[model samples]
Target: MNPDMSAGSHNGISMVAEGGYQVAILPADGKQLTLYPSLQIDRAYYWTFEAKADNPGDKIYTSLWGDRGAKTIPLTSEWQQYSSMGTPNPNYQYFYFWSVAAKGNVYLRNIKLYDAQDLDIVVEKEWR
Candidate 1:
């Protein structure tokens, strides 16, 4: 977490009993949580994760490689899986999830970035 963007006592990340983590980003203007993952240039990958907000209709903004790939994801109160596929921009190396004008806690689990070619094998193993 960046000190400048920190929400003081209003934001936190904690481990959940079942699995994964709970990330709380309180309602505020310009508060963002960023995650940087090592990615191979020019490789197509599948980005997948399960997430749910504390309340129905909460929204989260996600950006890949700065603003080159941006998406507005609407979240529900119940856990749901989200996924996207693309090659990372060679110029930037970042993935971000932020609260621009929304509030509430968001639970995230099984966050994965897998090679597009290997995704089927990974999914098969998970189902077995």
Candidate 2:
């Protein structure tokens, strides 16, 4: 597994948590995925972060930060799944995770990236 996924600057953010935190598989450096072309005003795109909560009964959520603003997608306590999508601008370049019930530990399986329209899947990139 890679340290960083296809994300942007984690400036004050992190992937580590004691009893309750973002619970992400963060990068050694704050900077994660930096798209080549960046985002456009109207170009639609989608990003996905897949994981299984250590406690299947725990609640988790997905968050994204872009030029527009911050968006949060809710998650269930089931051992199933979660995802989100949008047409973000190129200006913003950071994402955050929210834990509804992050009491114990959580394991992030994979954080993926992709094209918006066809939804082509892109593997999570390392911070190198």
Candidate 3:
């Protein structure tokens, strides 16, 4: 986590005991958390993870830097699996999750990035 951007009075990110991470957002606008992950150009990758928020209706916006656009993921109080497929731009390097308008704790687990060919295996073994 980037301390400078993540260290707000009421917002932060932390590891959870059971496995995974918790991102707490302050109850204000424009709160965000960014993650840097190495990605390759012209390769389609499958991004999958399970996530849940502290409250129903909370949401987070996610995207890969330099990708065409972002995705809005809706969260419920229950854990749910989400997935997306994209080919990163040559200079893409960051993965971001933020609540531009809402605020709450979002828990993430089983986050996986798989090459296109390995996606089916992951789905059969982990997502089933």
What TM-score does candidate 3 reach?
Answer: 0.67
Task: Locate the minimum summed-lDDT window of 10 residues in model 1.
Answer: 1-10
**Top candidate, metric TM-score:** 3
| RMSD for each of the candidates | 7.2, 9.4, 6.0
Regions of model 2 farther than 4 Å from truth: 1-37, 66-81, 89-91, 120-128
The residue ranges of model 3 lying beyond 4 angstroms of the native Cα positions read: 1-11, 19-30, 67-69, 120-128
Superior candidate under lDDT, 1 versus 2: 1
The global C-alpha lDDT for each of the candidates, from Candidate 1 onward, is 0.57, 0.44, 0.58
- TM-score of every prediction relative to native: 0.65, 0.49, 0.67
Candidate 2, 27-115: lDDT as tens digits = 32322323333445565555655555444454444434553323333333333444555556456544445455455444444455445
Per-residue alpha-carbon lDDT of candidate 3 for residues 1-128, written as tens digits (9 for 90 to 100): 12222322233555444633543443335555565556667666667667777777777666666543367777787878786666666675556566545566666555556666655554422222
Candidate 1 off by > 4 Å: 1-30, 120-128
Query: Highest lDDT: which candidate?
Result: 3
Residue pairs that clash (backbone atoms under 3 angstroms), model 2? 7-33
Q: Name the lDDT of candidate 3.
A: 0.58
